[model samples]
Target: MTISGEFLAFISLALVAVIGGVLLLNLTKVVHMVVGLVFTFIAIAGIYILLSAEFLAVVQILIYSGAITIIMLFGIMLTRHNDEESDSKGGGWKKVLLFLGVLAFGAAFYIGIYNLDFGTEPAALHEKNTEQLGVALYSDFVIPFELMSVLLLVALVGAIVLSRNDGEKEGDKE
Candidate 1:
């Protein structure tokens, strides 16, 4: 079988996503890690678009790549942290072990699913997906969605209050 453009795109996006995740885990700086996370988020959004979920792709980009990453950056800037790097004598060995473990898991997963066939045709779920999503979300999941929003708001307020208290304590000692 010949390689299709869609398959190539998927492979590229998946590779980028995996690389971003690895960078996020291995990076030393908080800002760098956030950048890696943004890369991963954007790649995932691309995959969503490839799968014809335009609404979900846009939401992924906006919510994850834009809002969440910005919030994380702001948190990193507002928090006090030391710029010193700790000496890790055994870090190299840990990295090697982690790499081997990841490879083993990947091989196992690939072997398990390589020859498996679902024998199913693709459904036209992309048609009216946004409308369907909106209807389901607003009608069936309205209460849960509103509750989640309120919970997030409370968490944001609590974070601000706690940070302000910490700032006041620092002022007291000065």
Candidate 2:
């Protein structure tokens, strides 16, 4: 029944992550949603550091907080979206239904996890985790890794093409 600093850190980080997710879901503006996503990413990275996986923590910050967030911003900037608010008359019922659904889902999730037994032994995975991860990724998962890179390149090309088309259409109208 002792409270440790690690436990406090974890609780705070988890709360921040949850708040960020809620903000992301409830935000009215796209840019504000992106800010919430960044908050969630950074909080997750902090949790990773607390878990003794420094390499994973750095990767989380770099890949998610840095690269992915920047990519999202670029995507947002590339696409045009109407910012006008829509009429929401009679939306109260829909909100009530959604809230009830979420409650049911949460209850189910809690029940499922209440008596879960995942074994008692701790994994000896803290040492040289980065090196081990690199070996596994390069040797066992090389093809998938390369394929993912190719997929990303294709997405980038598609975005450029779509934006160019939009520009040409606007020019034609002028």
Candidate 3:
């Protein structure tokens, strides 16, 4: 089968993203995992760009690759870790339970996906997605959008507060 350029690009990006995820899961070092995460984020952004969602692609890069990754790396570095090698791959009962859980999840996912009956009708493709997105965000979804923004702001503040080195914890008697 002759694949179009767009199809080839999508496959390449998908492979890169999958590889990054696999690497992130298997890597031992925290820093190595962060690098893999960056690859995954970039690949996802590339996919968004290919789909003509330029704003989403830029937002993905800015929020995920730039901010979240940095925050995660800092969290990892600041937290203490035992340097000893662990048998992370569990033994005996743990392994069996893990296998069973994975099997159950896979079966459920397959069944859920198989049961989906999307109709054959073509969807309306909006050409001016950015304009439509702006209008919807400002009009129809304005309350939800503002609420989400406030939620995110509160979460950020909470994270900062949690990460701060408050001297009270160091001192003794209450």
lDDT scores for all predictions?
0.93, 0.90, 0.88
lDDT string for model 2 (39-134, tens) is 999999999999888898999999999999998998898879887778888789988987899889989999999999999898876788889889
Candidate 1 has a TM-score of 0.84
Ranking by TM-score: 1, 2, 3
C-alpha lDDT of residue 37 in model 2: 94
What is candidate 1's local distance difference test score? 0.93
How many backbone clashes does every candidate have? 0, 0, 0
Model 3: per-residue Cα lDDT over 61-171, one tens digit each: 999999999999888998898656687555587768866997899799889998798889995554887887899899999999999999999999997778766664556
Better of 1 and 2 by lDDT: 1
Please report the TM-score between candidate 2 and the true structure.
0.80
Candidate 2: regions farther than 4 A off: 1-3, 166-174
- State the lDDT of candidate 1 residue by residue for 83-174, as single tens digits: 67899899889999999999999999999999999889887786899998899999999999999999999998997777675547655785
Query: What are the root-mean-square deviations of the candidates from the true structure over C-alphas?
Result: 3.5, 3.8, 4.0
